[model samples]
Target: MGDRRALETQLAVVAGFENPQARLEQYPTPPDIAAHVVHFADLQGDVDGRTVVDLGTGTGMLALGAALRGPRRVVGVELDAAALDTARDNERRVGTTTPIHWIRGDATRSPLCVHSDGNSETTVLMNPPFGAQNGRRGADRGFLRTASELADVSYSIHNQGSRQFVESFAADEGGEVTHAFGATLTLDRQFDFHEQETRDLDTEVFRIRWT
Candidate 1:
């Protein structure tokens, strides 16, 4: 599942193969990206066979990681077509019996937000926009609103740069940070392009539940 060539192709797809990578144009998450997965999985407490949702699931990194945790079903919702393609590919290449549903839509506008299919024991793991530069494009306050009504529990990702917004937004979402950790501790996990010496940045992994 962790094939090198497959991951390489995914990276190329994320980089737009032909276009230059720019924060202003397309903001793809770093390679491997294990911290968010760990954070969410931790907040999940004990999924066992519960359903899980992964928002802004680019390349299916977090979604796939959570799937390995034995969720009955895992859905990865992403807005980018390229990212969706890679996500589906990763599910096929890496392998998983945990049903994977990859939806093509922005995290803020979840197509399944209205679902009432009895998967109430659901958990969501999200890595949303940074609220920097064009970060608000397709990502805004609405995302938190949607999540509150959609899942019983969630783990949302935000950088120190957006502390004020995250704090306020979490309050509005009826959720709060159950655990906060430096990205440095997170970078300690497995990754494609992320490892020690990557960054000393700070990010919060908020375990949001009925605030």
Candidate 2:
């Protein structure tokens, strides 16, 4: 509703995961980054009056950000029940009028139907797992695959050096990368293996238009 700063302020109250799962790379998206992405999407005429879906919505950060905007409806698909519970609480705390549909299911194989007719549009937003963990490589690919199948346009975050991978995948899926940008993800130590108290990860965000 307001500027990016105002949106960030509203999202400041959104909480992180209580019991972080290492396998899922469960790190909360920074409020500033979320605000920036949502504001950019809004400016591109992607948020308002569209059905916005946030895949792997950890505590509803991006979903709530879009909700505060003028989206017709929002859907958050997450596999973690605990995370979804926290997301519901966050939604109440944010107190946005836009309705959000929280689905407790795997985001990669989301149970959402495509609504990409000329009259209606679907926008997918997500900060999917970066495939950092061993044996969990190419994790974000599944999320992108889902977006390709279900979204008219999609915005996603990935590791710093994933530009080539993302571009290649998007091209293969009949999508074009319209925009790309860099960001920093500050992650606090939430797992046993983390040696540092906090780590700053260089990341990238991409906006792709599916044809």
Candidate 3:
């Protein structure tokens, strides 16, 4: 119903993880970036009346954005119970009429079944871990895999310099990268290891069509 700025304003109320895990790389997706992705998807005709899934949906930023955009239903999968709790709270704060199902499970190995015939088309939205943490390389790979298995299309955000990896993965999985763009992820230092009060991360977003 609103423009991207309006969506970003709505999502600004979403809460981040109360106790973020370093291993999970649990930084919240910025409201502006979430708005950008959601609005782009909406313009592409992928959101309204679709079954939108947000994998690793920490605090429901992307999921809530989709919910506000008139998705028929939304499913948010996260492994942390506490994050899911916050997501529920954020859902209320966003005040969207769309129904959202928040599930507690690993997004990499999602618990959702593939859509059956006559079911609404599935579209996935995620800001998965960038695998920048120690011993956590290739973290976003699993998210992509899950999207391939469950969605007709997916929009994902990843660390910069990921185009090659993402393109390769999509080709191998029988998916095609239809849209690519760059964005800035601004993070206020939440964890102890951060050297600055705020950090601006260069990031990329990809829209993939899964066969």
Candidate 4:
């Protein structure tokens, strides 16, 4: 509607969707951070005419934010059914005609063949699992690999500790890291294991392009 700042405030008003017991780690990206990522993506590549995809769109913040940028289409790919329902609710709340589509499947293995709409450039935005839990290692790699396959450019979020690993993985997937920045992401306590009501973690946001 207005500037990116104004859109951020509007996004802050929307509800976040979450499921604590998911097999994959579930952390909704903070509204401010989501807005910031989308704003940066807009600057890097004009999101207005591109097809934007949010790979692990937990609550659709990134997808909706891209929608605010007037993208031609915004697709949110998520595995959790509950999360999808919440995302749909969020779409209604936003009250815009932005073409948003929801695809329910694993981010790592979702079939991408049918989405071959010709000529439109694609930009992916995802806040994937950090793989901190047992057996969840390398989860981010799957998201990166898929992004490389489906989009020309991607903005992925990961832990600061995983910077090297992420960079290496992207390079292997024929991606070049064009830009990155450090940020603190706020996580509200949503599980029994969490000791604090809210915690902030050091995180990195990366912008990569398919080489």
Question: What C-alpha lDDT values do all the predictions have?
Answer: 0.60, 0.94, 0.94, 0.84
Q: For each of the candidates, give the backbone clash count.
A: 2, 0, 0, 0
Candidate 4 lDDT tens digits, 84-200: 899999988887699999999888886554243564688889999988888998789889989989888899898887778878988888888889998799889887888999999
201: Cα error in model 3, Å: 0.2
Candidate 4 TM-score to native: 0.93
Q: Of models 1 and 2, which has the larger lDDT?
A: 2
Candidate 1 residue-wise lDDT, 13-90, digit = tens:
332112322342233444444434443454446344667788777777667766666677788887777667867877
Each model's TM-score, in the order given?
0.70, 0.98, 0.98, 0.93
Error of 3 at 90 (Å): 0.7
Model 3 lDDT per residue over 52-161, tens place: 99999999999999999988899999999999999999988888889899999999989999592474799999999999998889999999999999999999999999
> Candidate 1 versus the native: TM-score?
0.70
Considering summed lDDT, which 10 consecutive residues are worst modelled in model 1? 12-21
Candidate 2 per-residue C-alpha lDDT over 32-139 given as tens digits, one digit per residue, 9 for 90 to 100? 999999999999999998999999998999999999999889999999999999999999999999989999999998998857666659999999998889999999
For candidate 1, list the clashing residue pairs, or say none.
1-94, 174-211
Against the true structure, candidate 3 reaches a TM-score of 0.98
Candidate RMSDs in Å, in order, are 6.7, 1.0, 1.0, 1.8
